[model samples]
Target: MPRNAAQTEIYDALGVGFGPSNLALAIALSEQPERLRTRYLERTRQFGWHRDMLIDDATMQVSFLKDLVTPRNPVSRHSFVAYLHQARRFHSFVNQKTLFPTRIEFHKYLEWAASDFEHLVRYGQTVTEIGAWQDQGAVTAWAVTATGPDGELSTTLTRNLVVATGLTPSLPAGVRTSRRIWHSSSFLSNLRDWQPPDRPRIAVIGAGQSAAEITAHLYKQHEAAEIYSVYSRYGYTQSDDSPYANQVFDPQAVDDFYYADQQTKQSLYRYHANTNYSAVDQDLIEELYRRQYSDTVSGRERLRVVNLAKISQVREIGDKVRIELSSPHLDGPLDVDLAIFATGYRPMDTDGILAPVLSHCDLGEDGRPLIGRDYRIATRPHVTAAIYLQGGTEASHGISSSLLSNTATRAGEIADSLTRTGRAATTLPVSVPQE
Candidate 1:
């Protein structure tokens, strides 16, 4: 670590978020022989990825082989198996013989990998603006502006900017979160130490894995409360995780998807949407079904499955939320003491920070940035600063853009691009101090 809080005159790469994607990039940069001055800014005071939803018994959707380092460098010490070995749990974990580990354990694995790059990370910094750095009538670097914990603004200069700010929580149109309503992103935290009344009616909206998991969790936690899982679909659709279908997430598939015609790309995304979007794991679906069946056998069922139903309107009436249903099975608006929306997440929008720099970027017909296979946004020829993305590239890349399935390999590719761009050389008017 540096003896003082000294920043290099210009960073070779400055990452916007300290999440898994950028964390993998940091590891890749470190492992390479070339020394690229890099730094990561995280809005959180400490490192955490979906901490609120790190359910104890919940397993990862992706295989453990797709860890932060394995997909890029299987022999890297930063691998999850390496962490398990160092933590003295490798043998025990092997005995379980499961490809997916608990979400809690996976989060710990991520934190373990992140611990190695503390010197290159500055927490509690939220990036606000990004712009081209103009000096001597030429653009040389990107000026990244961010706000500190105390609300003071600071700017950093870097030749390359990798934005991996992650996804945004999405809710249904016209629905807002309140005391009685909340999204699954805040699931565990919102229900911490809180208990519903006896025979309380609860409405869980959406048909994704989160919705099923939350339903199962609530059923186990509050035995007396009635868990009503309301969704537009008649039943939860199982995700397509077959080996053949899983090929869509392969590293090579990204290249194939990128080069394919627009019609082919749309067809592929539409056909494989069930693999991730609005789908639940097969085992979890069976578990929920079994619970509902067992409860039905007992004659007093607390787990209610309200299928083919949609909440047309949600109104907060004092202590309860009255949700108007559109299905034929409903007699009137169901009044529930609590309603949780497991509505998934939206892709990261670059418009916020990229406003000042958008003029240099080429936008697609949809007004989205035109990104290359390297994940670098296509910019005007004069703009030398490279802008790479770790998320929101499903249009050009594939479905794995914002997912952990390809993060490790994706980061390695981006790191390779950084090296090939001639930005890895720490050369400037002022010498960069060696570690």
Candidate 2:
């Protein structure tokens, strides 16, 4: 079917992804007395944040106070506390006396907040390209091209663009994902598609939170299955959620980190890596240890932790995966029904999507897009359109750049910047020129 020719509209801001970052921005935009013409496009059919990793018993790492708007505006109606009150769970939640909420409950809160601005978001629309709309040799607007689920093409013109596409799942250099091999990002979805054998053996690679969670999940789901956790670390390192260390996620920390030199930034990231990097929750670490000890006491060694080990090679045999383990202690190959690499993710690169507009944006010595303190892309002065990033600015920002801890505050900053720039001046819809 031919795509219906639709007229383009010049928006104050066009958000690329409707995830928590952009969702928070939407709420911030709504709080402004002078409304900005904004539209958010999401590839998924609906709002979901790490749906596949929403493990049943998994709880959030951050406190509930760091919700969609609390850190920015405590009185905002879109806050988690506000949502709980609206859902009649506020009193019950308080009784629990826990800082972190269950992942399922948190997801529900996000959905409830997102429901308020249904009109502002378009689902199942993947943004394929973002081109600059030049007028008199100066880039004045952005031509946002997106394709809907039904193969219908649409383009919108915006004076400002906010890219919050989030992170991409990353695997090791030599490892390739296949039917039997999986990444932790697709754990639940992939598990549903496969039937475990009578004595299934599974291997979870990496030492991050996801790897720990998946190992625990597999152990609980398949009672008879043997689970192998492979990592170079001796054991899972507990994440440092201490009060002082937690300050790295504060809004003020972003300012400090952004103003510091590149050497200082690298040192800061390395020093605070445990705050968000390859570390597991202390409670979870204890829980897994308890399970491991219990198995030893009962003389049933179903759970094996292959510490100080590296995967030399991974090959698919007839019906199973052969993972060659290389370590000073172990000597042979470990065959498993499935091998899961919970190796974490890399930031979303804007180079491919923003190919048309990259020339106008400044790059640092590292060849990364230069991001300002306001999270806006440092484009040439003539290119008036603002290009802000919600993620992928860890180098310029701080450890909290991709974390939910500073999401509310970050969005508020972007909203303030947009308002100051006065990009919302043109409120009328316009037609896009054919390429």
Give lDDT per model, in order: 0.88, 0.89
What is the C-alpha lDDT profile of model 1 across 1-435, one tens digit per residue? Answer: 122214635788899999999999999888888778889999999999999888769999999999988988999989999999999999999999999999999999999989999999999999999988654544567888889999987888788899999999999898999878999999888999456777789999999999999999989988888988999998999999999889999999899899999999999999999989999999999999999999989998888888889778998998999999987677788999999999999998788999888887888898778998999999887667789999989989989999999999999999999977645333433233355
Residues 56-146 of candidate 2 have per-residue lDDT tens digits of 8999999999999998899998989988998999999999999899999999999999999899999999999998877777777888999
Question: How well does candidate 1 score on lDDT at residue 344?
Answer: 94
Q: Tell how far residue 14 is off in model 2, in angstroms.
A: 0.3
Candidate 2 regions with alpha-carbon error over 4 angstroms: 1-6, 424-435
Model 1, position 187: C-alpha lDDT score:
89
**Where does the lowest 10-residue lDDT sum fall in candidate 2?**
1-10
Q: What's model 1's TM-score?
A: 0.95
lDDT of model 1 at position 298: 96
Best by lDDT: 2
